[model samples]
Target chain A: MGKYYKTTPWVIPELPQSLKNIFKKNGKKISIRKNQVISGNDETALFSNTEKLIYIDSGLLGQAYKTYCVNKPYAMSIVLPGRMVNYLHYLEIDNSGDIILALRKSDIFTMTKSQFDGITEKDLKDEMVRYCKKAVTSDFDAMCCMFTCDTPQRLAYFLKALAESFYDDISTMPLVEIPLKLSYAEMSYIMHTTIRTIERLLPKWRSMGYISTRRNSLIIYK
Target chain B: MGKYYKTTPWVIPELPQSLKNIFKKNGKKISIRKNQVISGNDETALFSNTEKLIYIDSGLLGQAYKTYCVNKPYAMSIVLPGRMVNYLHYLEIDNSGDIILALRKSDIFTMTKSQFDGITEKDLKDEMVRYCKKAVTSDFDAMCCMFTCDTPQRLAYFLKALAESFYDDISTMPLVEIPLKLSYAEMSYIMHTTIRTIERLLPKWRSMGYISTRRNSLIIYK
Candidate 1:
C-alpha cells in the first residue's frame, strides 16, 4: 500500500484590496433547502450561500454539493422534448395506444375505435427494458474504458461530451468555466465520509494541481 | 487559508487478476539519456519504448520529451510547430517580420507582386508587438472578469497544454493501438511523482466516489 501524506496548498496569500472589493461588489449568495433541486433542464442560474460563479449543494439523498453536472448520454427512446422526434412512438404499439387513449379522452380523436384498440403495452415495455439494459451496458463499458485513462484522456473526453451538448466545434473551443454546485458537506455525503475528511482532502487536491477553489468557485483542472 | 491534508489511498487487499493484468501487460523497462530528444513530430511515437503501454523509468532533460505538437491556429503566425491555440494568440503579435520574410521566400504567393513587395519586416514586427501587449493585458482582465482563477487554474492550463501534445481520441477514430513510444525511464520520469501521489490519494477519492483505479486503469466519477 502506498503511504498517504498531507501537503499544504500553494496559495498566493493576501489578495490586493482592489480584488477583494471587486468580489464584494459582484458576488451574490443563495440558499438551497434540503431536497430542493437547484437547476434542471429549464433552469439557468441559481444563487447559493457563499458567492461564486456557480454553486451546487446536495442536502439529502446524494452528495451535499460541489459536483459537476456533466451531460449524461441517454437511449433513443429518451428523445429530447421539442428537439428530436421519438421513433419509439411508432415502434411500440402500447405507447401508440397511450397516445390514442389520451387523444380520445381529450375528445379530439378522429380515429376509429378499432384503430385505437389494437395497441398493447407488453411490447412497448419489452423494448424499453431492452433499451435500458443496453444503456446500462454502455455505461459500464464507458466506465471501464475510463478506468485506465489518464488525466489528459479524461479531460479530453469530458470536453468532447460538453461540445456535443453545447453545439460547438470541439477542436477550436476555448477552456470554459465549469460550474460546481456542491458544498463541502454535500461533497462529504457523496464521498461517504465526514465533513472533516472532505475538509482535509480539498487542500491536498489543491496542492496537487487537480483543482482550484475560490470563495465558492471550484475550477476543475483540465 | 484552507487547511491541507492528504488522505491515504484505499488499497484493495486482493486485486482481481483481470485488473492486475493491465499493469503487468503494459509496463515496459527502458531509459533515455540526459538531453536526449525523446520524440519529435517526424519521429515515431513520442516514447522510445514501443512494446508496452506503460513505461516507467528515470532520466534528465524531461522537458524536451514533454513538448507536444498541435495544429496551428487560424492566424498561424506565432503558434509554435505544436501548441493548443489559447485566447492569448488573438490578443498579441510578438513579431511580424519573420512572417513577412517567410512569405517573401515562398513560391506559392497569394498577394499581387506590388502588394507583396510593399510588405516590410518593420511593419509586420510593429503590428505584432502591439498585438502582443494588448493580448497580455486582455488575458489578465479576462481572468478576473470571468472567474477568480488561481494556481490550480494555472496548473490545469499547463496540463491541458501538455495533454494537447499527448492526448488522442482513439475511440472515435481509426487507430491501431496508440503509437505510444516512451522509454521506460522517460515514462517513469513523467509519472513517478504522480503515480505515488495518486496511489496515496486514490483511496480518498474512492471513498468520495470521485475516482476508481485498479492496476492500469482508472475510472473517473462523471
Candidate 2:
C-alpha cells in the first residue's frame, strides 16, 4: 500500500458571522470510515431530514452514484472536500435515485436547511452559490471530457482534477499523489472506460514517465 | 417537418412578492431565432454580468456545450423552457469554456443578480435552489445513462427527457413531438456514440415502433 501520511487540513480564511453562527448552532461534525456510504440507501435518504446539508470538511475522494440492481451501479461524479454535499436534497430536487459514497476516510459536518437560510449575508450566500456552480460545472466538464477527449487525455484530465481538488496551489506541487485507493475497475467506471483500457494505458503512461503506480495510489508527475 | 403546432405555456402557480418584484424590475423578455446562441462564445459569456440570470419562458429545446476546436465541441446538456438558464454564472461558477445554444426558437427573460437577491423570501430562494439542483442532477443522470445504458436505451431516455421537458403531463400526451432538428451526427455527439451507431439504431427503433421520423424531427408515442 502507498505510504499513509497525514497532510495539513485546508482552512477557510474567514467566515461571515451569520454563517459561523449557523455552523455553531446546527452543524454536527462526523467522521466516516473509508468506503462508507455517506448517504442514500434503503436505510436512509441522502438527507433524511431534507432540510440539511453535509459539508465535507476534509477528504480526498468521494463518489455519487445510482444503484440499478443490488450488484450493478454506476458512479456519477467524484466529490471533493470543501464542498457541500446533499445541498440538492435540501433544495428538494429529485435526484432520480442516487447515493453518495465515501472513497476515503472523511470528515463531514451536517447542518439544517433552516440554519443555512438564516445566513442573510450576500457575500456568504454568493460564496455558497459559487461552490454549487463549481460542482455543477465540474460535472459538466467531466462529461465533455468523456465525449471529446481521447482515453489517455481523459485519464490525465481526471487525475489533474483530483489533484487540484486536494491542493489548491497545484503549480508548486511537484508530484500529485492521490491518497485514495482506486482499483482498475473503479477507475474504469469513473472514466467511463473498461478495465482493459485502463490496464493498456497505464503502462504506456508509465513508459512516458507521466504517471507511476505506487501500491494502491497513482502518482502523476508535474 | 412534424406538424407545426402551438401548445399552451406552463404557468407558475404563485410567485413570492419579492420574486415578482424582481421580474418587474430586471426582467426583459426577448425573442430568439431558431438555433440562436444564448450564452457563451466571443459574443456572450454564460452570464455577461455575474449579476444576471436567464429564465427560459418558452422554448422547445436549447443546448449547453463546450467548443474545443472549430470542429470539435461537446454538448453539455439540453435546455428546456420553464427552467432558469445561466443561473450557474450568477453563482460565479467557471464553466471552463462552455457555451449555450438554442436548439429551437426560444423566448427568454433576463434578470439581475441583485434583483434576484432582493427576493429574500425563503420559498423563492428554495425554488431557485431546487432548479439548480435539478439542472446538476439531470446532467449527472445523463452521464450515468451514457456510461451504463446501451445506445438505443440511451436514445430512448434522451427522447423521453426531451418530451417530458415539453409536456409536463407526459402520460396525457399520446404522441410526443420533438420540434428540434437533430441530424444523426448531432445525436451521435450528444449520446457519445458514432454517427453510424445512431443511424443503425434509429431505423431499428423506428421498426420497433418506439419512434418515428417526421422530417428532421422525432415523434415518440407514449
Candidate 3:
C-alpha cells in the first residue's frame, strides 16, 4: 500500500481564460473574501437559489455540510481554481444542503442553465463540453479516492490533486518544489478531520521526508 | 444521529419498463449468473472495452476493486436494477479498474455512447436526459452517504437504500416489512467488513427488534 497511497489524480488543464472571460462578461461574477461564508439563502427569496453553474476562477471554495454533533460544520471537500461546481441539487425550500465558503479570497462566476443552453453556436458549445468533461474526470478521480482509499491516503491523494490543480503541468515536471498555498485549517476541512490531527500527521510525513510545510503553504516535492 | 442514520435515500422510481425496453431493443443484452465474475477481458482483445452505458434491468451487480492485502476483491458498493452505471473511465489497456460480479442472476444491457448521442430527436433526447438526471441524483445521494456518514450510519443508510431499490414505493408505505434480498456475505462486501462482523451486527439489530433475517434474505421494517 506504500505506492498505492501515493496515487495522484489525473492532471486537469485549467479552463481556457478566453472561454471563462465570456462567462465573466455574460454572467454574475461574485467575489468572496477569505474566511467569508456565502449563505445560499437570500433574505428576500425564501428559497436558496441554486440555479447557477459556478466556475471557480481563483482561490478555494470549501463546501461545508452540516453534521449532527459538531456545532460548526467542517468542509468535506474543496474546489480549487479551474474547478467547476455543478450537478448538486438540494431540496427546494430546505436550508440544509451546501454552505459555500471561501477558504481563500475567491472569485467565482455563475452561468444559468438557460444561458448555457442558449448558446446556439456549435463551436462554442463544443469547447464548453471539452472543459466540462475535464471537470467531470477530476470529479471522478476525487470521488474514487473518497470511496476507495483510507483517510490518510485520501489526504495524500488530495494534496497532490490540489497542487496539480494550482499548477497546470506540475505532474510532467522533474522533482520540483510545488508550493501548495493552502492553510492547515483548510487541509483539516478537506480531510474532514481536526486541525490538530492534521498537524500530527503532517509532521510525521515531514519527519519521514515525504513532504515539508513552510509557513502558510506546503512545499510538495513531486 | 439516531434519526440521522435512519436516512432513507430518496425514492428512485424504477426506470419505466417502456423506456428500458427501448434500450434493450437497441443494444446488446448480456446475462450474468449469480456469483459469476465477468472479466472485462475477452480472449483476443488486449483492451478492456468499457465503451458502453450499462442499464441494469434486474438483479444486483456488485463491483469489486482489488485492495492491497486482500486476496479476494470485496465489493465496495452495489448497483441494483434501475441503477445506471456511467461516468467511470479506466486507463486504456489497464485491467485494474473494476471487476464486475453478479450478486444475483442479473440481466444487463449496454448502449454505446454513439448510440446515446446519436439520438437527435428533441423529445426522445429530453426524456433520456431527464432519466439520466435522476440517475445522477441517485449517484449524488449515494456519494453523500459515503463521504459524510460514519460506518454504521452508512450501513444503515444503505440497507434502507437497498430495500427501496428492490421495491419501488417501499418508502411510501407505513411500517411495512420490506424484503431486502441481499445476503450477509454481500452485506459484508458492501460494508468492507467481514461476514463475521455482519453476523455480529445483524443479530444485535435483531435483538434490538430492528430487523430480522429470513433464510438468506432480510426483512427490513421501516
Off by over 4 Å in 3: A1-13, A39-49, A65-74, A87-96, A116-120, A168-175, B1-13, B38-49, B64-75, B82-84, B87-99, B116-121, B167-175
Which candidate number would show the highest TM-score if scored against the true structure? 3
lDDT of 3 by residue, B1-222 (tens): 124423333333356565576677886788878877644433432124366666777887765544442433433567667655542431111224456666789888877656765853666655555655554444445555555566677677777776656655665665445444667787776666678877888888889887877765677666
Q: Give residue B138's error in model 2 in angstroms.
A: 3.2
**Deviation (Å) of B39 in candidate 3:** 7.1
Ranking by lDDT: 2, 3, 1
**Worst-scoring 10-residue span by lDDT in model 3 chain B:** B86-95
| Candidates in descending TM-score order | 3, 2, 1
TM-score per prediction, in order, is 0.22, 0.72, 0.79
- DockQ comparisons of all candidates to the true complex: 0.01, 0.28, 0.28
Chain B TM-score of every predicted model: 0.22, 0.72, 0.72
CAPRI quality level assigned to candidate 2 from its DockQ score: acceptable
Q: Count residue pairs with overlapping backbones in model 1.
A: 37
* Local accuracy of candidate 3 as per-residue lDDT tens digits, A91-134: 11122455666778988887765686585367766666666555
List the pairs of residues colliding in candidate 2. Answer: A51-A113, B51-B113
The number of the candidate with the highest lDDT is: 2
